[model samples]
Target: MDKRINDLKKMYMDIKIPDNIDSIIDEGVKKGEIKMKNKFKGNLIKGISSIAAVFLIFTVSINASSAFANSISDVPVIGKLVQVLQFTGNKAQGGQVTDGVDIGMISLRKAKNSEEVIIKFNKSQDNIAPCYSISYEKYPYSMIFTVSGVRKFSAEKDFEALKQSNFISDSYNIITLDDSAVRFAINFKKPVKYEVKEYKEPAQIVLSLKECEKGNDKAAYIVRTASYPQGETLGILEERLCGFENIRIVKDDKGTFAVEAGTFESEEKAKERIKEIMNKCGSDIKLYIEKREANQLPKQMQ
Candidate 1:
């Protein structure tokens, strides 16, 4: 009997366990069994079954020593003995365990002639790559900013304050997604250009928006209605306005393509044409009267 007990101890000692042995044990206890508290100490060969006694002793030992339980919880039939323990439960909860580490509330700071937006986190998240997506829209002329890998974000107070700033003329909307991402739909008084910068230590993302410069020449004037990034939108604009005379698709230094309906000798003539276009295209289309010297006009338009 002594030799048998020694052999059982040695056999279990060589078994290997899993990292999530505690969770597995908790799941088993939730099903029915009472958790063992005291170390096993009983007669080796009492009027009970030897195998049952040895199994109970092993279970009690596992419950008493965390290191021992972790070392042998994955051993073949012994591992499956917990009933609730399975191969995939450990991985299923891994994301939830790590989701707490992420960016938190966002704030906006109004600067003279510009605005600065900052993202804040509980601790340094320098190791995580900040991924973002951007979209621009016409009519009211708005830009959408979507940032991923954020745990939470609140912009109510700062967004309200930004609306009152001289640089921001309209309201903004913020939406938090199910996958820990945030989206911001922002409208400006006029067309603006923006840039993004990042900082470590406390882990912050800074966004700056400034009004885009049109030009300084003033000998002639053009009725410019809309601008789009130099791609599909510009191609569609060109096709839509192909029948109109004096329509020019001009690419700016910032890489945006501006659509000019016509050039006139005076701002009044440009404004008059702008009114006609606005009436035809609907009130949402806002046009800008851009001044240009005779020499600055594109050779084709001149």
Candidate 2:
């Protein structure tokens, strides 16, 4: 075994060694280590930069969402996206989160006689439930309808065209109040007295306006049963009076929906009809003499 080991050692020493092999090997190892370190550092920097860029983009998107919501918040269908992100209040039927208001299309027309202006809300198409809170403010030459729980307005082609109608002395504007309300600014040539009417199945709102009357004379007389909230009461009244002609649902300036049994030119005539109305519709009927302008009489009375 000793002889075999010595022979093996002599053979290994006899093999010729390459010149500068150790230095070459050391240099190659050092180069490989440096290259590996450089590659690792480059990858680490790229990963960090990518993470930073993604974070920045995400932050900017969240911040910009509100501003974008304000601009197109009144556009139907697409507007709900903004409402979902920004609105934290009541939600509509279709998961549309709103401030509890959803306003739809508005329309204005002049009566056939051209003495009264009729403004209608094409509200049925929109998902607005019956009897939402609708109020109005009287300005110098404009009447502003502030409707609550409305998120947007979908303008009908006819209503849109009416914005340019000759009946309107000045232009009307629809402004968004928030995620769930809207204002309809109806501009006219002068101060006017207006009445509101709401219907059920079709889900419509009507604003009838006439120039203010002078003196102590009342414009027209209407027999009212009672004042109720805008929704179910108005609908019930409409159903109850469906069989009668000339009986209509009318709202006063105070946003009260009352049943107007009849309209007459004189108070005496209106009072006389009250008895007949009471006999037909129970004894709860009351008389209302509206001081409306001469031209502002209801279509039937006019």
Candidate 3:
């Protein structure tokens, strides 16, 4: 065994004589392995970067597409849309409704002229249950153009309604009372709509007689205004009060009920006649004379 070991050592020394040969070979192999590993790592990093960039692009594209879709929804239509509807005259069957008040929905209708548009209401479908009056004004800022007389409806909320009202009217056919001024009224069968935008008329009926310090004789005939809690219409009331043979109702520019009874000549005679009226009318009455026709007064009063 000693001889064999000595022989193996002599053979190894003869085969390799260079110093640090094992170290040099080991370093070269290790460097080659490291370079290959580095190359593989570099390829992995590039692949990862490419994947990340694609994923980011896809995410941004998705978000941008979604935003564009949202913006398009807010634009207004370029043209008008028409809807054909059937009018059975069966008033609106359901929805929020109030008592004694008529609710009507509106739609626009263009005339043959096209420029002229009308807010047409569906009257055929409108019905009144138990008979009632319906007064409606266009919503927002429109005046009521149509007022239906008292009619009967089978259902409570029955009124076929359509409209094309656009412009707003500050004045309409409704009469509005101003302040506490005493006003005598006679509703004619065909009563004209009076627009008294302002209250400029002096109080025709002086509630306080003390305001008129002058003796009653000073003023010939006095114009009086009175109202009844219940009774006949305005024309009927005027006929009863003004015993004139012919009576005509004319609408003053101010929109007041003027009973132009036959012009009187004698203020004293008119005053005497007023006394009779006071006795008959009981209490609430107002008196006035034709301010323009003072010449019609009695010779002394004039």
Candidate 4:
């Protein structure tokens, strides 16, 4: 399944899951198998939430018995188990301990120029993740990561490399929840907005962190409702422009006139305004959002 990622930090948190975790997982396994058999099926995932919905199964089964957990660990991706059996082995001595991918490495570092902090998990397989959740918290401003049905954690060698990073609090704590699960609690140097992305062939989980500004203005959205050639007369266009707030005809150097409505930093407000305009102006009027710095608007379009 594609379309980058699902919102956001916790895939399981935002998506609605069916009550039957067992059937959903079985369906995912069967679909994965079908995907394998059909080598060149062109139609792919239409929505990213579909994959997110499937992953919700893992989190629901976190407290399941050790045997059940083991079975979940073997939840097939394609034809093989989620783990690379040759490299990672189940550590359950006598009882039912779930099989999981061996954590090959945990790489923590800052982006070369930006203040972005990246945390990558190199697992034995592409779907390195099992039943996992990431939660963002305030108070001291921290993020927590937990996963279940894990086979084992690698030694502390690569984990020590995190000290080289100045992005986060530099004091992350790891707790072994049990033989089959683990938890990591980490704090940001300051408050940050985080994104989760996963890649397969080599099996990776990439967490991207961007420090939040004091006032996080995601974007300045202007809905360009209409446009006319600079020297042309307004004629019927002016009739459509009535009743809109901050309605302005901005003249750019390129000899074009833009009929824009509203300067909203809040994306939701801009979208609501767009819908109102679309409904009032009818579908014939083309409307789209243009993002720019709050101050740059006047300078670029006089």
What tens-digit string does per-residue lDDT give for candidate 4 at 201-224? 445445566756753334477766
Instruction: Quote each prediction's TM-score.
Output: 0.34, 0.31, 0.21, 0.35
Expressed as tens digits, the lDDT of each residue in 1-302 for candidate 3 is: 99999999999778965799899999999999999999999999999999999988877765766433333431231112122222132111111111332212222222222211122112223222111122211111111221232122222121121223122112212221212111112211111211111000110100000111222222223343332222234445565565543232333334444443333446766666566666875445454444332212111110
- Runs in model 3 lying further than 4 Å from the true structure: 1-233, 239-248, 293-302
Pairs clashing within candidate 2: 100-149, 101-149, 101-150, 101-151, 102-149, 102-150, 102-151, 103-150, 219-291, 219-292
Distance (Å) between predicted and true CA of 139, model 3? 42
Q: Candidate 2 versus the native: TM-score?
A: 0.31
Task: Report the Cα RMSD per candidate.
Answer: 24.0, 17.7, 26.5, 33.1
Candidate 4 CA-lDDT value: 0.52
Report the candidate with higher TM-score, 2 versus 3.
2
Report the candidate with higher TM-score, 1 versus 4: 4
Q: Model 1, range 1-302, lDDT digits (tens) per residue?
A: 99999999999997888889999988998654432322122343343578888898898988886545644642321211111112231111001112333555455555456766655544324433245555443223345555565565554346666566444554444423235565555555555666655544444455567877742424677777455654556455554555565554554334355666877888888888877766666576556877755323222221
Q: Would you give me the overall lDDT of model 1? A: 0.52
- Residue 149, candidate 3: Cα error in Å is 19
